[model samples]
Target: MNADEMARELASLGRRVAALEATARPPAVPAMLDQHLDADTVLYAGLGGWDGQTLAWQVVRGWDEIRSAPADASAGVLAALANPTRVRIATELLRRRLTTAELAQRLDQPSPGQLFHHLKELLAAGVVHQPERGTYAVREQHVIPLLSVLCAVLDLRPSVPWEDS
Candidate 1:
């Protein structure tokens, strides 16, 4: 072959090799199917959080184990959110840490005594914590778990609205 023709063929071959190299690279982390198990297990994962902070978690458990879990053990946590006022407090805390006064104001409470009444339930349930002084927030680890509980309840509906929250 002529010299120019040989050069052109070499460039074409190089391009094909580069394309192959790109496709041969390892894939990114998988977002689902954490294991090959098709059934008998469950996985709950979440990403995103209030503010710029991002959060993620993946909890896996055997269906049998989940079924066997004691309801009484978590009944307090569930009970904490049962009240609408407490629910609002928990959701606001998930958004950001807030002092008692800030929370009461944001929540529109005329009585600080009533606000503390609600905060007491959350603190006892371990869903919210006081990081410094009176400021309260949902811990990083609890964010996903809290959301998981809410999502489970929301799923109970036959057709939950797209923007229910």
Candidate 2:
């Protein structure tokens, strides 16, 4: 081929390579806020993910609502989990199903009454459900969301250089 034609062909190939690289690169992270929303006003109403025909939704309310809303909402779940006994109950339930008697014995509670008290709180908060007359287990829908909230709150990653070292 002629020298000029060879140069033109190389330039075309370079342009194609650049275009392919741009397409292959991962998408940039979106900015946290939209033009119309500020930190105080911005809220994620839902996070949806689709796989095949199934769609999973994680719902959240606005920041103001989250701050001011009644305890029966999101706050209730956290409050239910705040106690050591309740946390133990949840962790055990996460592993496998257990009856009230089994849970009480496993936890070494003084009485069934005390275990029932914690269980009631868990039930009201929708963290656990009685599958039948006696068995209790963590609600299936709440497992992932609870873990996500805990992870977000705890945020074990080191924030400072010294901490990392």
Candidate 3:
């Protein structure tokens, strides 16, 4: 096409793009805890992402109202927990806090190196924290939320005996 025709086509394309952007809805923001929540109240938070064609979500909950972290942060946490070793480490921490050496021993690691590697992943994901030198524990704020996500992923439901219905 000639220059004039090409210029007109580009201008039309820009206008269409501007119109689409103006009409498109902004991404949803996750909920936040407002005030001091009661102990019994269960709060669930979720993160969602869309990539043109596919959309995905992950939900987490706690006994008390908890604010949802950003999508990127939540994804990082899930990615860290996706590993078997990291899940075990987090579970061990749930029972009681332990030092790096104790955790390595309990998990039956031949050396602390491998354990530390997994621990580092957990630490970076914010699922586990080191309060002092050599000690580690699941972040208190993440315990219930992590369990909630696990339960949701597992899709736990009431079981019935074959003849009991």
- Per-prediction CA RMSD (Å): 6.6, 9.0, 17.7
TM-score of each: 0.73, 0.53, 0.52
**TM-score of candidate 2 versus the correct structure, residues matched by position:** 0.53
Per-residue CA lDDT of candidate 1, range 1-165, in tens? 999999999999999999998766423323556467657888888776455655767778898898898998679898989999998898888788899999998999999999999999899989999998888999888998888888898888658467577
Best by TM-score: 1
User: In terms of lDDT, which candidate is strongest?
Assistant: 1
lDDT of each: 0.84, 0.72, 0.72
Off by over 4 Å in 1: 1-30, 49-52, 158-165
- Model 3 weakest lDDT span, ten residues long: 48-57
Q: Residues 22-82, candidate 3, lDDT per residue (tens digit)?
A: 6563344433465465565665654333222222233434633245546787689889988
Tell me which of candidates 1 and 3 scores higher on lDDT: 1
lDDT of 2 by residue, 1-165 (tens): 999999999999999999998766433423334345546653332222222222232444568876787766767888998898998898888666799888988899998888999999999989899989899986656555655665565665467749656
Candidate 2 collision pairs: none
Better by lDDT, candidate 2 or 1: 1
Residue pairs in clash, model 3: none
